[model samples]
Target: MNMVQLERMKNDKGFIAALDQSGGSTPKALGLYGIAKETYTDESEMIQLMHEMRSRIMESPAFTKERILAAILFEKTMDLKVAGKYSADYLWENKGILSILKVDKGLLDLQDGVQLMKPIPKLDELLVRAKDRHIFGTKMRSVIKEANEVGIKAIVDQQFEIGAVISAAGFIPILEPEVDIHTPNKEVAEAILKKELIEHLKNLDPTYQVMLKVTIPDIDNFYEELMNYPNVVRVVALSGGYPREEANEKLKKNHNLIASFSRALTEGLNVNQSDEAFNHMLDQSIQSIYEASI
Candidate 1:
């Protein structure tokens, strides 16, 4: 493990940037960036355009370690070059930002009112590749749509099970069991999730500290205890479809939780904007998120 990076992650005052929109979410991400589906003829072209957009964001002066502690990357992005260096290398060496890879193979069909992550085949091989690329950690996500105890427990179990493997392989694993913001019983689900997570956290190996990426709890500081757990390095909140403003507001109310936003981070960015306009917009976004984080 990179001890410097680990220390920074444990103590950084900035938010993480979730730039890891995979195959399923890429189209929507592009559309929000002012690129239409009709603009790309094939998967290759779509991926290329998506890369271009990510590169643009990464290269911006505003996207630095000053306000962004790390970036979560798609596999392709980790392999691809940004400013003539591999994305992870560029992020760490040039920008001082750590890189985390999104390792889940997306979620399975809804079951027990939750969507558990699909099996990650050849995970060891991927971890080897990620480590070679200078990636610092891994992130996997599962979703909870209701307050079903059985479902929520299943989700947490899977996350910790996979997280243990990732940790054993020498990378911190960010276990994200996101509670759907639109769930009618969102608060109830959060309560159940908190209980399950605490139990799992208590049983984790003392040497392996993991991070968490979850939805902002329905109650302010509801996750305070989770943050204080010795086995927890940090607890970050996903925007989870909230508008940037609302997400920031909610985040501010939760003292220790920081943001790991996808859409909200790139809310007003457009592909056609001038460099000055683009950087200005990104600067504003970064400042807002950073302030909320601190």
Candidate 2:
């Protein structure tokens, strides 16, 4: 649950599959399979659909072969049951896929196209449940669209503050301060983000290691320092809506970070495909992502 546990998980050298879609994102992910939002008019029905989708994925060779070392799960998927067993247990016992919980309560809008993760009420209680469930770590998202110094600093401070809380409760915190790929000033944003992150990490206790999930930088060597930071277990990239091939190409050029991609990882996969076809598509995808990661 802490750095020791996270370091053990990292020894496996495989990418993390992020399937932690929630609320509107959940239905959007389902739509990839021609599933309509109306099919799940209630929360319970939606959860069932998500559970079924995850069950099929976990049963595949992509998982069984250990191509995916970890999976980031939405709250519903984190608690999902398969054959009367918690899905996390099923994956860990059967396939060596460690489970991670997405603890952010979604995003709240701020000005200038910036957003902060909604505060989780009773977050301490959530961490306790996650620890009991054997979840490996936690991930949350905050975004920077256009970097104003004040806004960027605030984003960095808030993330580390929450990250510290999560780490103290014995979870490896993945602090995601996503610089939107579409921003015209992505280079500047990455510069500012890198500076702020280093300052914050310097102040962090050396005992608590953390992870960072950020947008692929547009400039070369933009994150060199942070990538090699001693307390950073891994620096992972988010797809941020890129297609699988494009993301892979960009990822291949980066030497120090691996991926925790969601949409890009699932781009060629489809629910209507036969199991064999699904496996083939997924295997190819995982192989490419794996290659890029290393």
Candidate 3:
């Protein structure tokens, strides 16, 4: 682990840029960025376009360490380059921002009111590659759709189990057990998730610290105590499906939790915009999220 990056992560007054949308979510991401699905005929072409979009964002002056503590990257992005340097290296060496790789394959079928991560075959091999690329951490996401105790416990257990592996590999893990924002019993699900998370966090070894990325809670300061846990490095909120304005408002009500937004961060940015227009829109987005964070 890089000690400098670790300290910044623990104390930075900024949000995380979640630029890690994967194959399953890429088309929608691109479409929102003004590239329709019909424009890309195949998956490879689609991925390349997505990379181009990400590269544009990374190279923009508006996307910098001033308001962004770190960036979460997809596996393909991790392997690619920005400005002729590896993506992670470019983020750290040029922009002074840390990098985290999204390590989960994707979600499994919804079962027990939740969706766990698909099995990551040869996860250690992937970790080895991430480490070689100057990655500071890793993120994996699972979802909670209901308040079922059995289901929520299973989700937290799976997150912590994989988190331990990532920790042992020398990368901090951002364990994300996202509660569905549209779930009918959202608050109940969040309460159950908090309970399950606390129980697992209590049992974690002192040497293994982790970060958390969760949906903005229905109640203000719902995860405040979780943020103070000795084993927790930082607690970040995912934008989920919330639009940028709504997400920023809700994030401000929660005292110390910072943003790790994907869609909300890129809400108005389109590939067709000129450099000046794109940078202006991105600047506005970053500023709003940064203000809400602090």
lDDT of 1 by residue, 50-77 (tens): 9999999999998999899999999999
In candidate 3, position 95 carries an lDDT of 96
Clash number for each model? 0, 0, 0
**What TM value does model 1 have?**
0.99
What does candidate 2's lDDT look like per residue over 78-171, in tens digits? 6777657787787777776778899888778876557877888999988888877888889999988887777788888889999989888888
TM-score of each: 0.99, 0.95, 0.99
Provide C-alpha RMSD values for all models, in order. Answer: 0.6, 1.7, 0.7
What TM-score does prediction 3 earn?
A: 0.99
Q: How are the candidates ranked when ordered by lDDT, highest leading?
A: 3, 1, 2
Off by over 4 Å in 2: 2-5
